[model samples]
Target: MSIPLDIAALGERAAAMIEELGAISQSPDTLTRFFLTPEHRRAADLVGRWMREAGLDVTEDALGTVRGHWHPAGEEAPRLLIGSHIDTVAEAGKYDGCMGVILAILALEAVTRVGLSRPYGIDVLAFGDEEGTRFPTTLSASAAVAGIFSPANLTMRDADGISYRDALIAYGKNPDDIPAAAYDPDKVIAYVEAHIEQGPVLEAENEPLGVVTAIAGASRLSVTVTGEAGHAGTVPMRMRHDALLGAAEMALAVERIAKADRHGMVATVGRMHIDPGSVNVIPSRVVFTVDLRSGSDTSRRDALTRFEREAHRIAAQRQLSVVISAFHEVATVPCYPDLQLRLRRSITDVDRRAVAMPSGAGHDGQAMSKLCPIGMLFVRCRGGISHNPAEFAAPLDMGLAAAALVRFIERFNLPHLENNTTGAET
Candidate 1:
């Protein structure tokens, strides 16, 4: 017998929990909970308590990942994994990572309340770090669970000079036991994540929920534009080889190349630094950062090539020297087609206006994919605003999303669905 689902009440409760989780932050004014900090510990405790209340066994791993298990009795059965990161970026909105974690727990609770017996158990995971705000590396906790966290990251130190290994020890975690946190691929059937869209797509379509087709691959680069500094008043407009002006031109070119492709390719120059802090001095150098991402790697790389070409062309036109370097990047990740079908059906069950789109932002799903096939459901968030205090998700939208998750889980174990998995071919 399926217990009646009160989506409105569930949404209200989820909204309240999201607000409460945001409150367990390092700062009172903003949500900035990082990996293994005091605030993180408190957040873990609260989440653990919620898991216990939901009738699941809970434990915190060495790397600070909190897991709640709804272990099935009798024979060993495949497990369905649902999760998202608990850590937040600086001044983040309450809904980004934290909302997924809360929603996963609620989904499990709803399943249990319905008393549906299945061959697969359910586990809710809350990863320790996803933002890379405290350290230079991202997805440490999820990578550890995926059995791919590099040991070299342990020696990498933070701004306060605390190595990851040392930080683990300080947090009562044994670095040597990091490998034990990994989940066996054979034991897991699929991984599902319910997250806020963090973009304007769903809102633009006037929908409450959507299914993710893929998570975009990203390329990160640093560029330096160099020119001669001169007296601002004495230098003629044409005589000035201002690096700042060149950088501005290059930035605009980036937007042009990305939007010109017009297939969800995105390029952003988020950071820029100017040399010589004098109001009357012409800038000699400008350092800028580029973050380019797209569902299609070919489009992304082509845009990057054009970006660098345009940057150099602009620099030469202004008689400035330009240097471009690629630093970090990840390959484009595809959503499991089988799981996406289920997610799509689940959304249709809840709301008929469902759209399929690729995520512009990288997520924990990228790492978890190494362990098992992953799928995602994105609830609409207001203004596509995320990583900021202004981020907001309506309670009604969350209600529909919660119902969709419940629908997905209820139909996940159908034998026909298992007999024809697209994951093996992929």
Candidate 2:
């Protein structure tokens, strides 16, 4: 059972493989690999080749997800799923989504070298639509595996007016086969992913890795304020009812509420529009948007209610009419407590403090959670930068992440998750 881990070697291999995969982008000067494109085909092919080299059986699902299967117990045994998406944003860095797939490959290759035996199998998936830059839909690939994919998604078109169904056909896949991609819910143990922090928390804490607590749920709102128009030059400040001024106060209220709360809530007033935007005219109507996100669903809902009340109060004080409406809402997904503890122990065994944090950004796990308990391990990226070409993670840190995954695999046993329930951590 003794496995010699060459941490530096694993990191170097990860760096090299990331570079190789990143070179397959549609644009030569920058990385931009969309779903079902020629670039996606090449990347998936390369990943499949690596899986074969690592002694795993490789297969591609109908949605073009490349699955590397290692079954030490049997093909029908319950599986420990490990993976991340291979799709990238426009001008993306080399390590965002691709690093997770590379780390899984390296860890499994190490596992294969030692001929480790367990009662369960492992499936390293390389999904291709996480970025959703090509189509109007996102997480369609993972959704299929989780058995939550909607048939209407196939009609969603891209920038070129190409429907998702037609694009799949162009990629040599039949839409009818998508239903077969879902895994039997009874046969899944749990889903785990390793990814960059995509934020500055890990970097600021000076930690190499952290365990995710939950994927933050988000609520987006549109607030509109209405008032009688007045001449800015002639109306007295004490008598004029300005909708823009009332909206500005509501925006401040959002910041104050988020900052005063203890649940790590973040709210942003990212967009605003004022009618008759002129220097000599008082704004008669103002519309703004609020995006609120938190790791606790209860806390988020409470915050929304508070904001609504505060907005009405502000409008009433200013003698202006106000209306609030929600445009988008997604519930928080908590990581399974058992998986979180196991992942933390794995990182601690490697002599690193495992900080527990929530992922503010969206991930494929949000979709995968529908199938089983889910967990995430995050690696620190420079300045917490992502979705841009400037993103970078140290090779040494990546090596440590890979080593941690190997340790996690080594310590895994089927009984640990047999009693675990999905969505039980919230």
**Which candidate should be chosen as best, given lDDT against the real structure?**
2
Candidate 1 regions with alpha-carbon error over 4 angstroms = 1-3, 73-75, 231-236, 414-426
Weakest ten-residue segment in model 2 by summed lDDT: 416-425
Pick by TM-score: which candidate is best?
2
Instruction: Assess candidate 1 and give its TM-score to the true structure.
Output: 0.91
lDDT of 1: 0.85
Model 1 lDDT per residue over 116-227, tens place: 7877788899998898888888999999888789999899888898998898898899999998998887777777898899999999999988888878888999999999
lDDT of 2 by residue, 10-82 (tens): 8888888988998999898999999999999999999999999999999999999999999999999999899
Q: Which residue pairs show backbone clashes in model 2? A: none
